[model samples]
Target: MTKHKCFLGLAILATLVATPAQAEEVSRKAADLMAQNSNSTDSVDQNSNNTQPPNTPLSPSLPSEPLYGGSDTASKLPASNYWYVSGSVGSASPGNDVQGSSIFNNKLNFALDSTSSWNIAGGYQRGNYRSELEISYSSFDVNNASIDTQSFPFSGNVSTTSILGNTYWDIPTGSKFRPYLGVGIGAGILSGKIKYQGQEADLGTGSSFAYQGKVGLEYELARKGNAFVEFKYLGIGKYQNDAGRDVTPPNSYGVNVGYRLGF
Candidate 1:
């Protein structure tokens, strides 16, 4: 009976010791599982922050090349070619020694008086060059005449109308003023009347080749307008009068003032 009692006591002691050891092992395993779960959650949060979108830019980008061939400012410059119209009025002085033949077959010479002249023109201007079509008119009075060296006061007048094609070269002065040289070739019609020693005569209308030369100074008044003063020389070929006499028209010199407008 005593041995059985002892055995029962030993069994009770062994169960108590094994129960505490198993409880310690279970507590350690629970701590390892909690630590693993916390590490996994932290890794997921780090990945989300790295994958977020990047920041936006502050300004737009610009182009590298120019819009035109020459330079950036070339496309904004004004035009160099244009069309223009002009008009002028001036005084004309004819050459003194105008020679012709009288109906009585006598050699005659005339001295002409200063007269008024006018012109209108339309043209195209390209940079320093210009081309134009012009119409002009003038009238001269005879101051005196000589029949083979015997001089006499004369009463007569001659008028001319001309159409010309003209060209000019403008010199650049880097200012508002420009100097120009011009030449023209064309046709003229001459017509008039004469009364000498109480004998009335008609100098019949006739057409002849004509030419002119010019030198001028131009002042710019605005972007599309200018004023000018010029000196001109005009000449015409010979033609016949009503009396069937060949008449040589005199060459003329003129000083003109004018204005030009551009389109």
Candidate 2:
């Protein structure tokens, strides 16, 4: 036992006095000597050394990016692409020698009065041109009626409803106000009542070929609204009503004030 103790003491002193290079070499040798006593501790150390940083792996290409913004393309589109609707109210000025029916050519020499009128229309526009369909109504009360320029005839009311397809060319002044001229051709229906010699007669109803010409100007009010004034000339064909009351109203003229909405 005394001899074993002296040997162990000498080995420890040698290790402590050695240089770093020599120490590592000597430690390897000493670990071999300590293996019998330190095997259990070495097992724990191996478990700790097993933990390490993870390695990154290669991946596929990234996906494409997406586009942005609103889907309401119509709102951003040009003015030419807009569709619009309009309405108007105005006066119907009558013409002379309103004839009716194939019967007596019962020519009516009536002194007609200007009266109230209204119209509605819808259209599509592009550049400086527009195309539209319109329906208009007007009527007047007669103060006197004659047959063939003689003062012996029926007197009462005359009314007409017209539907027309129209197109216009806008004259731009580089301002908010736009002026235009247009023409239309379509059909009109006429009907009303009159009295002759204390006997009342139904003016009846008739459909005739019709045509018109118009001039107008529009003032922009809002982004989608406009106010306008228009003047128009109307020519209607002769036709008799259901009551055999032959009548053709004279060509008439009118002036109108209107509003329009667009999208």
Point to the candidate with the largest lDDT. 1
Q: Model 1 compared with the native: what TM-score? A: 0.69
Per-residue lDDT tens digits of candidate 2, residues 152-174?
64578888899999999878666
lDDT (10s digit) by residue, model 1, range 14-81:
55776877756655655566667668889999988886456745665776764432222333322237
Per-model lDDT: 0.81, 0.77
In terms of lDDT, the poorest run of 10 residues in model 1 is 70-79
TM-score of each: 0.69, 0.65
Q: Listing every candidate in turn, what is its Cα RMSD in Å to the true structure after a full C-alpha superposition?
A: 12.7, 11.9
**Candidate 1 clashes between residue pairs 3 or more apart in a chain or in different chains:** none
Per-candidate count of clashing residue pairs (backbone under 3 Å): 0, 4
Scored by TM-score, the top model is: 1
Distance from true position, residue 182, model 2, in Å?
A: 0.7
